[model samples]
Target: MEYSTKETSEKYSNITSLWRANSSSSSVIDAETSPVHVGPQNSLKENDKIEKLFGQPEGVDFKQYSGYVTVDPIAGRALFYYFVESPQDSASKPLVLWLNGGPGCSSLGGGAFGELGPFRVNKDGTLHSNQFSWISEANIIFLESPAGVGFSYTNTSSDYNFSGDSTTARDSYTFLVNWLERFPEYKASDFYLTGESYAGHYVPQLAQLILVHNNHPKKTIISTINLKGLAIGNAYVDFESNMKGTTEYYWSHALISDELYNKIISTCNFSTPSSASKKCNAYLDQIDEEIGNIFLYNIYAPLCNNRSLSSTSISEVDPCLPSYIQSYFNVPEVQKAMHANVTNLPYPWESCNSTLNLSWKDRPLTVLPLLHQLMKSGLRIWLYSGDMDVVVPVTDTRYAIKKLKLPVKTAWHPWYLQGEVGGYVEEYENLTLLTIRGAGHFVPTYQPNRALAFFSHFLSGKLLPKE
Candidate 1:
């Protein structure tokens, strides 16, 4: 999620590194508590059930893909999406669900653009080829979760105002069930729930929910869960870590003066900080002017900075900022692939370009509780952060993990990719936290090669090398 004039909430690499913490945090073994109850898997019966619940795709095309749709059978009127990359043969592969967070943002931005989708954007705002895509390495699915996000519309356009983390998780889980019927091969594949930003909550809760249901006699049954792991870049897992990390990252980078840093640290008790909505609002207000004057999202834009583009210069294109959103969304190929009619929408796909008309009033911290439930059920959980993002910094993710209170399984260590330092890693009970170097909120867009290497390590159920 990107920030704009409006009020709302804003705010990954693949198989290269398997990081191990320096110290042991806790044990990964646990007893099952809650039981997952998924009824029969009669394909015909399930398909009929979902169709009855959610209508067929509006103008969206699934010809290239094979999957079923589950309408807002539970929510007011939100569509649930589940895509599959089935095995060429009958063998089963791991199933991974990808989510991008914007409170009101669509997964298509992150899930499709930054991570597993097969394409990327060029500096000129044109779509380009992505050769190191994650989906190529594993079976990946992207979702337009909750209602009113992406193509997933609702009867309540007002539903935009009704969002919270818990509601999102619950709705997401419901979508998972109906989605499973659409592609049953994944029902037994090692399941891994993953996402970024607010997804800090989405991935954990969804995983825990699956664990709970699996423990039940009638609910769904999952294999080892391969629970294998998950990775987050600049995740907002913990509020304290998030805020403090933001100031810290800026301060360390010399963006803030020592005096100002001291004042911020002394004034803000990250452990139990007050709402900086007013103060943060003021600060952003100042930054807003600068952002416009510079015609850049961050303080620095090499592409925008250079009068001429050199072959060696970083593509002047900054993929993560909101300013390029309109042009990015308007790409003919993108519109065609997403089944989006860019002209008809009232707002931009990115929240940064415009005020946030959508409401995060519905979001709640539901994933923490769900994480506890999963840990009790012997599920493996992992959380990661990309160090460069301010929206959902590493600090926030650290804070979120602290809340877990699980014993430390491994101590902090640097995770490396191809022998180069990638990020830091920590282990606790069944959970792991990782940080990717030089990657922002959208890890793939920033470092696709690293993302690919990371996912490669993860799917193999191995720990990345520590260098």
Candidate 2:
């Protein structure tokens, strides 16, 4: 789910033209695997259980399932998902769908393993429990959306080239509907959407689409997705605010010079055809020169060692853990356990897909309206940012909220965890602006305990404690 720092303004009207891949790659399909037909209600017994997780860690008592839900079977296209039931009493827990950003990144690899899933993948290719895992509070679902991300693939090659925000939303919704038919027990469960980074665009857009479909004329045919709320962390909500915030964050944090900042802010138009101008790019380059080799997502975190495959201790994961995860997911046993690689995909499992059309034609300049629309629908909306994240920094999140002008329901105050100041928040009508004290772009990975604490509160309709 990675996007270029620059944004493209051209909008393509024809959706079919977007996904034309080289015909040679996916023109064939196996006869045994036919297009899936939606089954009758309560006929979900088949996909309700996961056979194994290969080297699944000890002390895990939860039931988890991993498999593909056919999104467009004509294309033999399917999206992969990893669902973990809450360890203690999932029947009462809400179903939360977690997505990761890169626009093409793997949510299972990033969000599930690296952040809030029940377990984290060790460098040695073993599994370990994540005590702060979000599944501890709710039945978490991690989806590898759009064909070509993670194990999700297409037999019709063109689907790879045709992915964008709209298709992604449509297919993700389709996956949810079909997935429910396979597990009808959760059809009426309250759904809460969560994601970060480029998912800032994905989560809101999907929520907007779900809201629209909730009132479709033929509503009975479509299963009800009881959408209750959404939570986005270090998200890219608004382009102007994000870009302006990036520049301001660099300048304010002494990453850029006063002169360069002044020159770009004046010459660089945030509303450019590509969302960024040449002069703006040049100035950012200068800042890059000064911040050499540091992780932009978590400027203070230690870098991972690629060769030895070591980084942080078991306590905290290295941001580069994605490499280790890539190795882990590609294993035959792991794939078999996860019920993945059904058609023997041509390519290896990757963390960020490069085949996607980077010149996305459907991306909206800003998702602020979608956020507004969701809030107006009486959905619980919480925007949380990791203060240490420079990509979509906390300052920009605050700036975006200020622009929304939601009437303040509670004055700004420190929110506590374990008697310590975890962060600060200002509650607005139907929305909450929150900051995680020491986390980076991926809050769950960086500050797991606090992130889980914050999330537990958000999901339970309880505010972050003031003590």
Q: Where does candidate 1 stray beyond 4 Å?
A: 1-68, 73-76, 80-91, 123-127, 216-229, 271-358, 365-370, 399-407
The lDDT values for all models are 0.52, 0.75
lDDT of 2 by residue, 1-467 (tens): 24221221111101111112111121111112112245343533445467667667766698988888877767888889999999888999999999987677789888888888887787788887788888888998899987888899888877766677777888888888888877778998999999998788888888877777786655567766899999999887766677677778878877678887798678767544344556556665566556566666776877655544554454566655766688888899998888889889888887777546454435555677668777889999999989887778887788788778889999999999898999998899989988889888888888898999999999987888899
Number of backbone clashes in candidate 1: 61
Candidate 1 residue-wise lDDT, 123-185, digit = tens: 456544455666655677777766666556555556555555555665676666755655566
**After superposition, which runs of candidate 2 have C-alpha atoms over 4 Å from their true positions?**
1-48, 273-277, 306-314, 357-359
The TM-score leader among the candidates is: 2
